[model samples]
Target: MAASFQVISKLLGRLSPSISHPLRQYLSCLQRLPVGSRPGLSPFVPPSRSLCKAALPRDEDAAQATEARLCYKDSPWDYLESEDYIEKYGTNPVWESYRRNHKGGIPPQKTRKTCIRGDKICGNPCPVCRDPNIIIHHQNVKLLQQFISPHTGMVLDPTRTGVCMKQQKKLHEAINTAKNHGFLPFQIPFVEFSGADYSNSHDAVGSTPPPQSLTSGETWYKWYSEITPDENEVAKVKKTYKAYLK
Candidate 1:
């Protein structure tokens, strides 16, 4: 940074006479200054690349790998494997370990949207939000399964699981991705169609004419024939409502 200033000073020194009085004064100040010093400037030090990298959020692939590696020891199941799961929780699942003690009459339905606000984390945050190290990945089946129903094969509601909406959404997306990658079964709703719906045999849709119109010398539709009401039935109906009809 000092070297850049020195080059600028040299250029300005040559054109000092023609330049404005303010710039000339500034050039004189630069010359009078020490080799590495500038007027009204603090010392410059470049940040280490390692430190910069540490400052940034990890990429999805890196986060997944880190989560997987940690899961080998951190989570009991090694992500939904039976042997590790049996060793860890025995027959029960992680959701069974519910923290019951609370100050309020009714416990909260769900966790907050986020734990940290501009680098400050609130006290006693939710399980999902408490740890910065916990990452949601498609391959993390064991953790993902906790947010899903074992018997019903549906995602557990955020209210029931006490998961924040943000984390719940992430869990949802990861579960779908894992299913797409063939880790879990894609549980889709069952649909049944009536047999008649598939056939085009109805009057509005069918291409064929009436059944016996061609053979029996009758109009294709009976309504197309010259129509007359029974005189007695028409007169009785008219007489029954004569006041309104008139």
Candidate 2:
């Protein structure tokens, strides 16, 4: 609109006074015409130049073969094995950088139950829950160690770590699995045992009963209530397995 007005003004300024007045009135009438009623213009006209995207045309097959697939599935152990992770994070998790942008006071002990819903991620996701690429595998010892307390040999509280409860649960399960698999050291409280604690008590010194005499029974020492199978259930089981028994 501005460009058209400027061009009309320049035309008026250059024209003879007598012609300018009629030309200006004509231009004003032209402007007042319904927008699409312009003589050479049509609403159906395609914006060809704007619609076309510039590119070097290539074979669709070749493009598909060379196109990179998004694969950021880095396992915990992968973080230690690959130099790329070290380069990007040195020693920090992916969330460390995101966490530094916190607006105010210390983060809450536990973040929301979850930081993700459907396709949207929350504004402040917990460190572990924020990045989808950082997976928790039992073999990822380095990643697991970051959440563990070196001195206490315990996992850090979610509050201190700013982890969401969902991720925190995953973290606990992963850490435990790592410990069980020997990827991480299982920490137990150290207890000083006195000689009296293991002294030769009558029960400790007692000999085991003959295996033949004992047969199948409750426990070796503690006599807990026996779990008697339900008669009706037993009858049902017998009926179900009777064919196989024969």
Candidate 3:
């Protein structure tokens, strides 16, 4: 009977609340923790809300945008067809407007290499060439003036004016022809002195000596005086000759 009672006591101790209470408490604590949280793992941390927002563009980006806007504002060829250009300038040498706009700089477009139909070997043809009827000549004074500087009287370079070699040659010829025809003014005349004159008259201007004497030293001349020599003057000559008289 005592053995059975002790066995019953052991079984009851095994089924006691000591283990159950600890396990229940552990489960309750686990449920209370956040879903993202783990005991030994790092806690859940999201990026800051400020960092998640998009950043504004920097100064460089804004500058690029401005430049793009400026680039698109006007086409490079606008001056070609502007009516204001025609009125402000004139039709005498209409191309002057275009040259003025692009002076000291290259045009945006390249000149054509040959005639469109290949009938002729044109070195460089401008925009007007493709459309025909635009002629260049010495008579076009205004156009030629644009190529020449008003201050220095020198022709502008091809790189600055975007003129090809062939056109530049023609332009020079035209300028010369214009000058010959009085359409362009020739360069102002300059004074230059030739070498100095060294003639005898030039040397005598400030001479110190009087005119040369009628007779030089040791020269003989017949006397024109009427009176003969005096006795004393004749005797003096005889006395001086007495030593040779013997």
Winner by lDDT: 2
Model 3 misplacement above 4 A? 1-133, 194-246
Q: What TM-score against the true fold does each predicted structure earn?
A: 0.45, 0.50, 0.33
Error of 3 at 181 (Å): 1.1
Model 2 has how many clashing residue pairs? Answer: 2
- Cα lDDT for residue 127, model 2? 72
Candidate 3 global CA lDDT score: 0.57
Candidate number achieving the greatest TM-score relative to the actual structure: 2
lDDT for 98 (candidate 1): 41
lDDT of 1: 0.67
Cα lDDT for residue 105, candidate 1: 88
Tens-digit per-residue lDDT, 13-104, candidate 2: 89899989986886677688887775542342777665344332445544643431124353345545566567867777554565523546
Give all candidates' CA lDDT scores: 0.67, 0.69, 0.57
Q: How many residue pairs clash in each candidate?
A: 0, 2, 0
Residue 98 error for model 3, in Å?
7.5
Q: Residue 114 of model 3: what lDDT?
A: 30
Across residues 11-129, which tens digit of lDDT does each residue of candidate 1 receive?
67677576745665766677787866755433334655867787566676678756665766455334446454456556554545545335788877656776567878757554566
